[model samples]
Target: MKTDRRSVIIGSALAGVALFAGGTLSAIMDVADARADPSPEALAQAGPLGDVVLGSDQAPVTIVEYASLTCPHCAAFATETFPQLKEKYIDTGKVKFIFREMPFDDLALAAAMVARCVPKDKFIPMVEMLFEQQKQWANQNARQELFNIAKLSGMTQTQFDECLKNEEIAKGLIDTSQRATKEFGVDSTPTFFVNGKILKGNRPLADFEALIKEAAPT
Candidate 1:
């Protein structure tokens, strides 16, 4: 929270990378270059399924997350803390969960595209697999490995290719990232909005549980 927003986000302890669909290609996008406020019209726009949301729409608390697939902290939360939160909160309709793509780079953007291409019902599961096996599909020889994971989500290679190359999908993801930066000052991965309160970085499950308990409608 001290450094320049762009520097803060781009300089997170990003410890890994991922491969894109069909392999043999990669790109690095600097988050700094993605700085801009959307126009009023653009502000009203949204991505596929308006980004993945779960739990009852009537849940008293809404938790919105901005995460980058290549981010280790993001992966840690997904692996260690998310399940407990999901079990105690989302699954019980105690909290409405929203997961938005805040891709840290082009490879991440590609992964995000694949997640979105999945069936809406399968989105969370697909993302869980991506984070769970991140090391497998986040390297130079990740084409086939990624395909295997995509297959688990019912995405064919043809669909995978089409998805990575889809301009609209790419733009939608970019817009989501840009809005996160512009509106929320999201400079790092695993940034959580707990009932509209910003919780940056990878906080423990207990900490989040407390926030949920405090925010839940009485």
Candidate 2:
């Protein structure tokens, strides 16, 4: 298949990043036990693309997550830990969850773009599908594979292609990532800011619970 402007968009976005061995999963598996001081003001700063948040706005605790689409650790958290977190915290209005894109490769950027193209209400479900079916699609034939996934959400082939070629969406994701790296020292996939306290890695749900409890108001 002939490449399209989507390729150019990916190339432009990943220009400086090392394309080492065709961008193997860059997610760090075992992140060190580390945390950063809370930056509530910085965490509250809105991105250009705007946030698709989950749970009540008045929730006591807030979680801001920056994850890559192609990261296995991120998939693990999304498919496994996130459900429990959503059930116990988000659904209960105890925590507000915010997901931000931090694409690690060209494929990841493409996936994030497609996810953003969907209606705002469908964003979480679209991301859930991407994570659950990651093994099937995150490959050399990423374009077709991602289109297949998008189709499941009623997205047409034209929409899929258009989403991939959308430079504004692409740039928004890249800018979000750059700001994350600059302001929060985010260097790995699945990095999170729980009430503005940075936590790295695909930690167990218990780890999240502990932080959320601490952040919860007395």
Candidate 3:
């Protein structure tokens, strides 16, 4: 599959690129350059989700993943590739994995919030569920589908409704994603930052294993 062309901004306000079926189009915006922070405070804030340390944090290899729950490719990666990666790298402590939200639509955003609503210990499982059931939810009516899935996670209708309507949480997620896009130049779902080097799209396990070996410390 042909991946979309991603535009990296070296200055202020990263522009959004539209992804079409066959190709992508982007318009570069000229603006005052924003100074890049060698270590962003956002990394610190990610701690609530889990341990996200700096400077070869956890291990020599670090994988920062950006994914959307509604994206088919994101679902594919989670289902087909994440388990092997987890067993080989994450579980062995050879790599530290960070999962970031990259919602492309309101449904995706809502699913992101749902994953966050669960306890930290359940976060990964909830996210996996979201991806595993993507087709079922994606094909159904948005509101009903979301509520039904939330039920699986033990969220009541009222609780799910409130969680979805929480503007503060929603804004926080959007801001985090915006920071990733503006700071790291991420433009698509399932973009992986393997120790700050960008790898975009869902690829086979062999491709990731090769990158992992290259990133891992000797």
Model 3 bad stretches (over 4 Å) = 1-57
lDDT of 2 by residue, 108-211 (tens): 77788889998887888899999999998886566678878888788998787667667688778877776776566676778888998878888999899888
Q: Report the C-alpha lDDT of model 3 over 98-171, residue by residue, as the tens digit.
A: 78876655556667776777667677777888899898877756567767777877888788766655656666
User: What overall lDDT, based on C-alpha atoms, would model 1 receive against the true structure?
Assistant: 0.70
Instruction: Work out how many backbone clashes candidate 2 has.
Output: 0
Model 2, runs deviating above 4 Å? 1-35
Candidate with maximal TM-score: 2
The lowest-lDDT stretch of 10 consecutive residues in candidate 3 is 11-20
The reply for model 1, stretches above 4 Å from the true place, is: 1-49
Residue-pair clashes per prediction, in order, are 2, 0, 0
Candidate 2 lDDT (Cα, 0 to 1): 0.76
List the candidates' TM-scores in order: 0.79, 0.84, 0.76
> Residue 167's C-alpha lDDT in candidate 2?
69
Highest lDDT against the true fold, candidate = 2
Q: Return the clash pairs for model 2, or none.
A: none
List the RMSD of every prediction in angstroms. 6.0, 7.3, 7.4
* lDDT values for all models: 0.70, 0.76, 0.64
